[model samples]
Target chain A: DAGVTQSPTHLIKTRGQHVTLRCSPISGHKSVSWYQQVLGQGPQFIFQYYEKEERGRGNFPDRFSARQFPNYSSELNVNALLLGDSALYLCASSFYRGEGQPQHFGDGTRLSIL
Target chain B: AQSVTQPDIHITVSEGASLELRCNYSYGATPYLFWYVQSPGQGLQLLLKYFSGDTLVQGIKGFEAEFKRSQSSFNLRKPSVHWSDAAEYFCAVEDSGTYKYIFGTGTRLKVLA
Candidate 1:
């Protein structure tokens, strides 16, 4: 089966602009999570959606939001983009949401802010 | 606050040499631990994970990690290093019952032929 997939392999936006990143989970997966990986750093959890409901959220500001579709696909929206937002946005999926559930990650969308 | 730490930001070793990457976590209790490897411009691949039972866990690509509760460490080890092993390694920990991961800054490995 194909791995998790993400759209817009790359994106560029100016400060204060809004950006929407999309992710398609693997077939039969029911949970999706988003993470941000800045340069020289590991990924930080952003949000997780299970069964189209928000299950968990990271410490990001309100400008960062996400939703899951009925098909288990997910979209991460970041508003008021700042230079600090320039990083690779990764989307992960799992069979379910709970303990011992390992996530499968996508190549990620590289977002650059001007 | 709970966090993960990788003391070595970068490591270099000759091919065929043994390798060991350190990871430490601070949590109230023993949390689920994981090791992930990321190639340049790529997403992370799960190397291994530890939840319970035997403290030692084996994973893909000849990787293994031993969870030591006393030291709060889950260290990744490989008997021999290969050129293809050069990449960034991240240590992640999640609180019990919570699937969210707290990742370390990552340790970059450099392998010499």
Candidate 2:
């Protein structure tokens, strides 16, 4: 029973460059969500995908986008990254997008934008 | 608009001492509340959650939280803290019927042995 797993544990990119972070949800999970955690702050929701469909989005800009694959994996892509984009990107998954279902999170990807 | 506030930015306590972390939320209806712990360079882990029924909820790692409707507060508590318990704690709330969650700024706990 593996928990959520994310790739490219760390990444560095310059302004105007784009980066993609991937996540594989726990087996048999069907919902994947993305969050961004800045230094000294709690994570902020970015997007959520259920059954390969976009279910919700946060107050993020259009430059932040995500999609869930058929296998319930997900990718979060940030375009034209700015210095402020430097943060820890987290991926969480739940058996279902239901009330009271707590999300399980991955170790997260540390993104540094210069 | 739902939101959560963790008034304390950081806290320091000696190991084996009692600990309490405050959390308050703003929402129209009764909200689904949760407490999550995040260690350095790690993702958030659920400590406990409150939906309804009992106001007090026990969680993993010997953590517990009490929900007070009148105060709009869901504070986490532990009888005795351990060094390994040092981490960032976040309080989150979701609408009664929605899956969307709003998290607090988080409180960083520093345990001194």
Candidate 3:
């Protein structure tokens, strides 16, 4: 089966603009999570959605939001983009059987803010 | 909050030499630990994970990690280094009660020919 997929592979936006990033979970996966990775650092959790319901959220500001679709696909939306928001946005999908299932990641979308 | 720490920011080793990368985590409950590797411009790939059972867990690409609860460390090791192993390595811990995954800053491995 194909791995988790993300799109726009790359994006560029201006300050105060809003951007939406999309993710398609692996087939049969029920949970999707989003993470933000800055240069020279590991990924930080952003949000997690299971069965189209928000399950968890990270410490990001209210400007950041996400939603999962009925098919388990997810979209991460960031409002009021800042230069600091320029980073690699990663999407991961998991089976979410009970708990602690491993997450499979996508290559990630590189978001740049000007 | 829970967190992961990789004391080494970068490591350089000669090909064919043994390798080791250190990781430490702070959490309240029994931790679920994992090791992931990322090539440049690529996403992370799981190397291995530790939830229960044997403390020493073997993973893909001839890598293994030993989880020591007393020390709160899950250290990754390889018997012989390969140039292909040059990349960034991250240590992550799953939140026992949630889907949160806390990751370390990452240790970049530089393999010398």
Q: Which model scores highest in DockQ?
A: 1
lDDT of 2 at A94: 90
Residue-wise C-alpha lDDT for candidate 2, range B1-113, written one tens digit per residue? 88899999999999999999999999888788999999988989989989899999999999999999999999999999999999999999975545867889999999999
Query: Candidate 2, residues A1-114: lDDT per residue as tens digits?
Result: 889999999998999999999999999999998989999988898998999999999889999999998889999999999999999999999999988778888999999988
Model 2 chain A lowest lDDT segment of ten: A96-105
Ranked by DockQ, top first: 1, 3, 2
Colliding pairs, model 2: none
lDDT of 3 by residue, B1-113 (tens): 78899999999999999999999999887888999999999999999999988999999999999999999999999999999999999999998677678999999999999
1 or 3: which has the higher DockQ?
A: 1
TM-score for the A-chain in each candidate structure: 0.98, 0.98, 0.97
Clashes of each: 0, 0, 0
Error of 1 at A58 (Å): 0.9
Better of 2 and 3 by TM-score: 3
How displaced is residue B89 in candidate 3, in Å?
A: 0.2
lDDT, candidates in the order shown: 0.94, 0.92, 0.94
